[model samples]
Target: MVKGYNYIVNSFFDYLENRSKAVDSLLCVGLDPHIQHLDKPSAAAARDFCLEIVDSCAKYACAFKPNSAFFEVFGAEGISALREVISSIPEDIPVILDAKRGDISSTALAYSNAVFQHLGADAVTYSPYLGSDSVAPFVRRPEKGVFILCKTSNPGSNDVQILESNREQIYLHVARQSLVWSKHNNIGLVVGATDPYALTRVRDIAPNSWILCPGVGVQGASLKDALISGLRKDGMGVLITVSRAISGESDRAAVAAELCDAINRERESRKQNHTVHVTNNIAVDLIETGCVQFGDFTLKSGQQSPFYIDMRRLASFPDVLNRVSKEIVKKVLDLRFNCIAAIPYAGLPIGTAVSLLLNKPLIYPRRETKEYGTKSSIEGVYKSGETAIVLDDLISTGGSKFETINSLQKVGLNINDIVVLIDRQQGGRKLLDSQGYRLHAVYTISELIDEWLAFELIDNNQFILIKNYLSESA
Candidate 1:
């Protein structure tokens, strides 16, 4: 086995991300030794064909995907050749076996062994149609990666993937469910580049997850368009998979190098063109959704204020809620938390959206414990000694958070971090820090006010009022 492959298997995505940066490419080379393209229809010919491709293009490749069906056609010899090709890949480059295997849990376990142990693939793609049990075996090995087929590149994908469930597309449902299944942080989505709309929708739902996008070249998908629609804010989550376009070329290495350069150029262009800050987008959405209102208002703490931020309105605007959730997910990605603990009332919707996006279990402290049933102080399933990251719409004096924190601690849950959409700059962070907890906010109240003023959404008087209010409170 390659050195440290076993050790790094647990963090396959991290390995892939590092490899992508080292090579400065998101190109995932596809090794499909087609019978017609081979000199002879034999396993030896297939092995040689792939070895040449790897030897020529390994430096330019972020990862290599070998379609198992092409090799499996040759039976035992083909399987042997497949193993040889994977073992020959460089230690840093991840190999994804496009097996698309789907079966019951027991049968899936055997399949996992064959692909991960026998063939030695770093990751494998499988169908999620059979539900979680069928996929349990593959994802159970947290070190190994699994990509669930979401929106495929094929034309017929629309027949079923577009079907609506609860007013949302089936593919989107899979994207949401993929988050829940990614508790190990080892799961990704396989989205075809041919459908940029589908790719965009998937990106919106799972902004931080790695998406393997096929159909970039011979399949007639535009690489630039796919990157524009599918790339994460950091510009590193989308992998462009190409098979015939690179392997079929006489000068494979040159084609691979050109493709890599082209992809980088597009990434750079997107970065340059992305002028609007993420918080700016949220600020506009907040205004349009009426979450942020100006003029005289009474604060919950009985203090008079020139404006009020009613984040509860987010639940009424699903699109705005989704956009906000995506940003929150980005902040939560680097934190260590067993689940989410949303402060009740305004925090529930925001927390629920964040929970769905991060695939983390969500629990909340009810304002009043129900007298009937279990009468538990906290809702949702959780275990003692687990860390909980507190979620809320906004934080002001940091007083309300302690109420929920105290309730959570009463149940033996550990609280180390709190995330919110906006920090009102009223000593909330200081209060939290003094209490042995960290606060993470997507935007400070001052930043939001500045954004609104810059966009001409708020007048100078309104901006000044909010700014003074924040300063006085601080």
Candidate 2:
């Protein structure tokens, strides 16, 4: 096995973000299986065609972005074949469902479930024009991922994305506004490699965000130049998508290998590039990740709750983790803690990402430290009496937070503040207040519901049900 490949990659984002490093390549096979490219009209043949390409090029790919339109054209049978095609992909390789779907609230959510749950897609492409309500369902399920259509390599993309709006190009506004929807930090943008202006501007707006660059093959984008403009300072940020260039070749794997090596060489040629500031739209991200849910769920309190909240889903999204860490870094830098600690189970990734982002040390609290390894409840180095901020993904009854906080205090790590992604408002805030600690959160349940109502994601009865439940629970 390859060096990093020996270890388990847990999520779609983790695989795509690290595969380039693991395999030393960034070539992603774009599985656009047009019927014209095949000899038989059989759905099984189409499935076989994609499987062959994957078998040929899977080793060279960081991910596979199969345009849903192609499979969609085949109707029900084609859809079944698409599922088989998706299942055929290796577990460690992320698949992006390139379906630029955009609609409002619950409708968008149904689409979100279709892509992430039913289809089992690791990530999907979406149009952002319907605004936050339309995108929230996708963003809310932040464990899965979304590549918002920012700028494309096609000729007619200028009709809207590039047109001037509010003294700026519409695409920049889209890039800027995306952060608001990326709360769980799982958001990415799609910019065609052929569009130089967009490639440059989007990076400026979302410096730390990943840009999926298409239009590299038959679309005539300069791969070298696109990499130069698009790569993050680490040279690994952008996903360089080369579809036809590799697919049309007689030796598809050979072509992908060559392109992979070329892209790696180009990225290495410019390692000094700086990373960007990342911001997220928490409501959208939380919803996309399935951290926030509507309908009946029984709470640990023995009461039925209308909404279920959990932010552990955030760990699966590398892009969202990066953005959330960047946001947390901004808040924590001012606090100037000597180290960072996280409550185990959910907050581990968020805390680790923040620690790396801040260049500080990290320690995670175990429910009980391993009897085998240092026999201490807390792992990692920390000085006694040193200050550290706590990271957790959500606060419901504050049941988990207090336990972890007490453990941190026992170690002499002074923590008077805790940061979380969501404040469910079901006595979590008051519980912290009673303890003389402040709760900092990216979004509260009230804010999320308002967004849902505004976008008509929930009807009056549904909205009233949620609000009244929270009100009574409070």
Candidate 3:
């Protein structure tokens, strides 16, 4: 496990990350024993074919995905062979059964059992056509993972996937709903590598979720385009699947190694490019949306400043709010929290967006308890001893955050981390650290100013003024 990461393997994604790091590869070798590739159309032949691929490519594979239809064609013997093939793979590498199973809760439970318990596969591809009930059984087990079908690689996917629902595409809706179904943090999406634009859209909606991309070689999809569009800022969110590209080759191991190296080269390049693009875009969006302003203003803390940030304006721009919320999700991805506590007034809408995107519960400490009705200080359902990460628009002196923290702690909720869109580069982070709380931000004041100046959005004078103000405040 990497340092500073909460690497407790409570989910299949966790195990996948560990294996990816150990092997330094994001390649998921596909085990599809088609009839033509096998010596004969028999269960033994299929089993032997996959076993050979596993033996040759296991070292370079972070995961092995065996399509269930190939083995299930041989009936009982084929099913037995499938189990043997799954069990034969190295335990350190995860196995994803490409079954695309979905049904009612009861039937889904049986499918889950057969895949995870009976066959010992760590994850499974699932169909989301029947809705959340069909997904409940598979996602109930936190240790397992479910990759719901979103935008598949088939040519016919556009017929239904691109259909508009409430002014949004069906596939984008699926991407959003995947987060709502991921309460256990074991859900991911199946976005094809063939459509890089769709892949990019899915990444924007679910920035933290793992994506399984198929259709690279046989489907004529470019691996570089998929990685550029799908790789997360940390560069480990995508798993590229290649079936015939490796299986049809004479030296399977050599082909697998070559693919692995190609992926790493692209992954590194994408990581560098994505970081710069996201930061600059966010700075421009904040300015254009009036979230960041330059004028004499009195802040809530009764301090005079050269500029002010009003993130509350984000509520008026749905597109900007969605984009900003996605960036915030990236910062909150690795933090361990049962729910998020949004400071009232400013943090409410941003927190709601993040909660929906991450499928985490949202709670807020009210400014004051009402005299009538329930009169509870906190405005959401939560239990004692549960951990919560605090969310706010920005932090200046840390005075207001403590008020919310105090209210939350009075109700027995534990608070250890706070996340914000921007840090003012004041003493807020130092104060939080002194109180045993860590502060995470998407951007600091200096970084935003630097970006703005570099892009010619702000003049050199304004940049120097803000820089001096930050230094004086410090």
Candidate 4:
């Protein structure tokens, strides 16, 4: 069991990083044995049809997730049919039994063993509203994964999940709670691809966890919308489940292959568009027009600086900031951090710009909380146990950043990465590294100087002064 457990964890993470070429989305074919549908074709014929569908989709899916409700209606004979159908599929594909079982702990243990040992499934979906007692038993199995229902894809999901207090959405609250529930277990979310809006919400909560999305094809949800909504900034984050559309087609294999091709094509198109949109025309203009300036400049850190970025001017030039924020978000998309912590004053607006542009929550930590309301040190929608990337206008001595990072850490938030519009490189990088943070700068001080020199933005004497200041500061 230990050896098997190690094997599963190692392989699954590897698969998560280098997704299976066979199945891009874990889009499973739903094979419910309807009595009426099976009547015309004998049980043997129905089994043959199911096997043929599997053989057809073999090249297109990572796993074939089966909905148990279809087979359970048949009693013993139906159960027998399910086993035969399962046996027909190959062993390499991970099989997810979408049997959303919610019962006592002991019963769950038995079910877990039955699903993993007897039936040979890699993962099973489960209900967690009953709390951890029922869910933990299955997760304890190590290799097996238990996907909990966080925000479902149904239109009626809002009936219970949307009510709020203190301006917090109920579903968002659930997403936060699930982090604790998912700890130390291979847990994932069962989100419906049809609910495009909810896709971003759930992703905001569990950015690193894999999502199993249903509601493509037969449900009429656009695959394109799912890709845009479900994808992490880095271009991977979900296992899409498509059941009826693929299984019910006349030429099942051909249809499944087409669906696979469609998903891949949609993903590629979205990736390309996302890249171009991030660094769009307005961004190019900013570089061409000197809106993002470069020269011999003095930084607030009391260090001689070589580069200066006037992101503050973006407020007056609304269109350019909009374009810049859009591009910046594209770079930081899917980084899975909690809130966008904008360095106060200059960074506040850009942070707001990014949060508003992406439609994500915003939080700016104050040197001190307001006199009214919650009096929280951090403003906006921020929760503990979540990671966040600190966004700043520029970095120099890194003193201001260290202060900001310290305040966030006091509130139980993880601050390991810092994103800036410009990197002054005047001991800022070394300072940040000493404090344990890696910097992600849009334009390094060196790059800005080089471009400025090439464009004749600065003369040789001015460039020399800037270079001397940077060297002395370091």
Angstrom error at residue 397, model 3: 56
Q: Tell me the whole-model lDDT of each prediction, alpha carbons only.
A: 0.88, 0.78, 0.89, 0.69
**C-alpha TM-score for every candidate:** 0.59, 0.56, 0.58, 0.56
- Candidate 3 lDDT over 227-308, as tens digits, reads 8667776888999999999999989999999999999988765455435654538889988889889978897768889898
Residue 9, candidate 2: how far off, in angstroms?
A: 7.9
Candidate 2 error regions (>4 Å): 1-12, 272-474
Model 3, residue pairs in steric clash: none
What tens digits encode model 2's per-residue C-alpha lDDT throughout 1-474?
212356654434565677667788777789988788877877777888888899999999988988787787788988898888888888777788989999997789899898977787888999988887888888775557888999988899999888998799888898998877866667888998886556866876787787889988898888975775576656666888988787778899889988987897776544422221112655556667786788799987789988887667777878777777777777666575788788887888888898887788999888866878568999889989898888887788776788888889998889888888667787888888998988888777877775554443554346556766777878
Candidate 4 Cα outliers beyond 4 Å, as residue runs: 1-8, 11-19, 22-26, 39-46, 165-170, 182-185, 273-280, 283-474
Q: Taking the tens digit of each residue's C-alpha lDDT, what string does model 4 give over 385-420?
A: 788789987787788798888888888889889888
Once fitted onto the true fold, the runs of candidate 1 whose alpha carbons sit more than 4 angstroms away are 1-10, 275-474
Per-residue lDDT, model 2, residue 403, is 83
Which residue pairs does candidate 4 place in steric collision? 23-61, 23-62, 233-334, 338-387
RMSD of each: 22.0, 22.8, 22.1, 20.8
